[model samples]
Structure formats: structure tokens, C-alpha cells
Target: MELQQLRYVVAVAETNSFTRAAERCLVVQSALSHQVARLEQELGTRLFERTSRRVRLTPAGAAFLPAARQCLEAAERAAAEVAAAVGEVRGRLAVGLIPTVAAVDIPGALRAFRGRYPQVRIGLRVGPSDELTEQVREGTVDVAFLGLPATARPQGVVARELGRDPLVAVVAPGHPLAGEPVVELGRLAAEVFVDLPAGTAGRLQSDQAFAAAGLRREVAFEVTTADSLMARLVGEGLAVALLPSRYAPRLAGVTTVAVADAPERVEYAVWSRDGRTPAATAFLTAVGIDPEAGEARPAPPQEPPSV
Candidate 1:
């Protein structure tokens, strides 16, 4: 009737004594005997024959013993499988990557991760930084690689720094400033700029830099896609834009020059506090970042200057 009753039946049959079965089951002998008796009564059959000298199983008890053992084994195996699933890092993990993040070797890392956790299914999504940040906040993606502004930290998210990508001036190979190690914003104000839209973090950082210098840049072309295409356009001498130095596409005719006193954008591995998963943690570990230790810390406050 009950699983414990079946276990009692199996233990008694194996030991040939209710006293030993009670010891094995960690219960009193009378309690074990009463449960077995209750089980037999519920089945309307005599499961055991009791004598003053020995306890023996009837033919019916012998027939039911095997099934009871099998049932207990099934229960044990089910519990083990569930425990393994929970204890081991094996499940579907969704990761988001911004197209402009070029420092992380995602393909190489993923190949290695697959080799280690073959059972973990990896799903990847590539997009701009804004969308990826939103995905991390919404719990649609387990983790994301984002190009966030220098001082920008998203709410309800934990971010680990992968690298710093400073905004740089990228020009055609034949351009005059192509070989310059660092160019001032005042000098670049006259150049035809291939810049991102007004609202993007990269564009805003550039705008702020020019504002600090009291300069205005002439936007010759505004690009929406911030990946290799911007580099290709710069390579063709269409227009020079301010782009992250790390993400400057590997184009033959493009040259990247760091902007003097430019604000550096940060690349972060972003994940929600509530949505962290074992698979996500494993992936973070694979990339050499400890998810537990990489909790985002508040920036230090600035000291007031003496007038």
C-alpha cells in the first residue's frame, strides 16, 4: 500500500526477521511488523507465515518482493537523476553579445565551454549595446556583453569588466592624421565625421569631449550599424567616425588613432541579480571572471575642490 510498507516487506523478506528489518529501517520491531501486517490486510492476502522459531515469507510474499524492490530502486534512481541535474552545470543558457564588442573571443570561449559542458545548450544573440542591456534587465537573456558608457551602470544588474574601449578617431589609411598616435579634439573638429546617431553612448561621449573643448564637429555621415561596416566606410574615405578602439574593424585601408583626453567606454558582462543561473556562472568562469566575486561596486565619490 505505502512505499514504506513495501520497503518493510522487502527488508523483512531479505533479513528473514522483523527485528533485523526494523534495525535496517531504523524503526521499532513492532512498528515494522504492524506496517507489514497492515499492508497484507489491505491486499487481502497473507504475505508471511509466523512461527515461534522462524519468520518466513508465503508464496504470495515471495512474488510481491521483487516488485517492491523494483519500486524502491526506481524511486532512488529518480532522486539521483534530479540531484545530478541540480548539482551539475547542465542546462540551456542564453547569452547576448553586442556587435561592437571585439575584445572577447566569444567563438573560441564557446568552443572550449562546449568541450567542458557538452550537455549545456548555448544560445547566442548578437545586437547593439542598448538592446543587449535591455535583454539583460528583462531576463530574456541570462548574460550579455555590453558597451556601456563610462559612468553608466544599469539598475538591478551586476556587471564585470571585460575591458576598456576608448573612443578613437578612425580614418582612411591615406588620411593626414592616420599615423598620429593621439589627435586633439580641436584638430578633428574640421574633419568630415562619420559618427553614430546622436543618442548612442559612443556618440554622446564624443559629443561631450568636443563640448569640453568648446568645439563643434561637422557630421558628414551618420551610421546606424556600429560594426565592421563603419570601418569599411572609413576605409573607403567616406567619413571618419569616433569608434571604440578595440572594435575598429580589421580593414586594410582603415587607420585608428586615439583621441586625446577622450572618455573610455567600458565593456561589461552584464547579468541580472535574480536571473543568475548555474550555466551562466559556468560561462563566466570560463571567461576568467568570477560571478560571485565580481559584484558591481559603487564608484568613489569625488572630493570638493578648494576655490
Candidate 2:
């Protein structure tokens, strides 16, 4: 079948409407339907079952869909590679990150990358660390920034440690512990807390630390986004929270106290081990990271003037 036919099929399958798919593919409904019909005839099976009310993939369509998408992706990557070989980076860059990432300025980095490579299309996904890591390993995400407890590393991917910071106590400005310059985990454990959802990497850092210290802190509020809802809880004097020191300070209307015996959280940048897209490599470099070494690439020394 033709690549255009595959594209039409995928668009229809995703949108579940021939008319919408044709609109998305910038073709008329009849042309798109004809192409799909031709492909189905060539393969001797219907890819989709169409009713006036709804459209759904047939069993054969379900089987054919994944391979069809892969073929399209392979074709796109091949084109991107040829462009890169000529010193032009043109491809889709899918980036994933945790909500509480603090190691790098993600917005600024993306802006710089966009300015440098206007031809590249960029997409961003915000998710938990574990999910983001898995997306990177699966090649669904080209690059990811994650925060995990010190005891863990991103499995089955190429990762670089971005930075590590101890967890700090965040409380309302008028909270009793807010006045303290430093507080121990045991002391913070005495207070009700707001934290990431149970079993998440963000929450695990504090949980493992408190358990190790032979303390238990009651997490009265569990939130997915720590920067907003969690901080709001802390600022309202509803509960205290343990957050990475680098990120806690940036929260408004809250006081951050150093945790003397806090757990350490590590931030990491991870990518697929199989290979990196040229767009991904360019993004890393634009953000001052070395794609191969997974560290900051040193700047080239200035040349001396010839007299």
C-alpha cells in the first residue's frame, strides 16, 4: 500500500471519522475513503467497520494499525536522518518531565532550542518520574527529566544524574517549625504533611527516609502536582511537606526549613539507549548538556588573534 494510504488509515483510525480524517489529511472525504478502500482491497480485508453513527476498527484493522504506524515513523525518521546529515536538524522532539523538575529551566531550554532550530517541532509531556522513564525507554519520548529517590535509577535507558538535593520542610510562614533554620526529620514527622501520591517516587523519598529514621509522618493530603496544590496546602497551614531543597524555596507564601536528616532526591536526564534523534541531540546541546557524555559539554576555547 502507499504511504499516503497508510497515513489516511491512521488518521481515520485515530479520529474515528472518515470526514475528520480527510480534513486532518487535507484531502476530500471521497479521496481518503477511496485510498483506504484500495488498501483494504489490496490486503483482502476491511480495516475499519463503518456505520453512520460511528466508526470502529475491525479485528484486522487492529492488527494492521501498529505496523502501519511504525512504517510511518520509520519513514519520518529516515527523512530526518538525511536532513541531519546535511547539518540541518528537522524532526519531532518529544520531551517528558516530572512536574517538580528543578535541575534545569525547561521553558528557557525549549525556547532556546526553538530559536536555534525553528524547523523542529517540539512536544512536551508532564508525568510522574516512573512513567516518563518508561516513555523514554519505549522511544515514545525522545528525552525526559525525572526525579527519583537516591536509591533508584532509571532502568533500561541512558541516564545522567543532573543534581541531588536533600528534602526540606515546607510550612506556612506562621507555623511553629517555620521559624527554625533547621529541623530534623523526626521533628517534621510530628506534623501532618502534604505529599505526592502514595507510592510515587516523589513520595517514596520522604517515606523511605522517615521509615529509616524510625519515624512516621501522616500525609493528610496527597497531590499529583507538588508545586501548586501541595504548596497551597502547606501555605494554608493545613499540612507541611517535604520537597527537594532546590524546588521548595521557589514556592510562594511558604517557609522552607532545611531538614537535618532529610532524604536526598536525585534529578536525572534519560533517553533511549537504542539511539537519539537528531532533534533530541540538538535539544540536549542547546540545554548545555553533552548527549554522549550525559554531562555539560565544555565550551570551545577562544582563538588567539593573529598579529
Using TM-score as the measure, the top candidate is: 2
- Per-residue CA lDDT of model 2 for 159-189, tens digit only, reads 8888877787888989998778788987887
Q: Write the per-residue lDDT of candidate 1 for residues 1-307, one digit (tens) a residue.
A: 7889999998899888999999999999999999999999998998999988788899999898888876875564455456457776665678998667755777877998999888777899987677777877776688888876777755568878776666778888888888777888888889888877877765777787788789998887787767677777888887888777666644445787877776777888888876466677788877767787884333234222111
Which window of 10 residues has the lowest lDDT sum in candidate 2? 298-307
lDDT per prediction? 0.77, 0.87
TM-score of every prediction relative to native: 0.65, 0.93
Report clash pairs, candidate 1. Answer: none
Q: Report per-prediction Cα RMSD to one decimal.
A: 18.8, 6.2
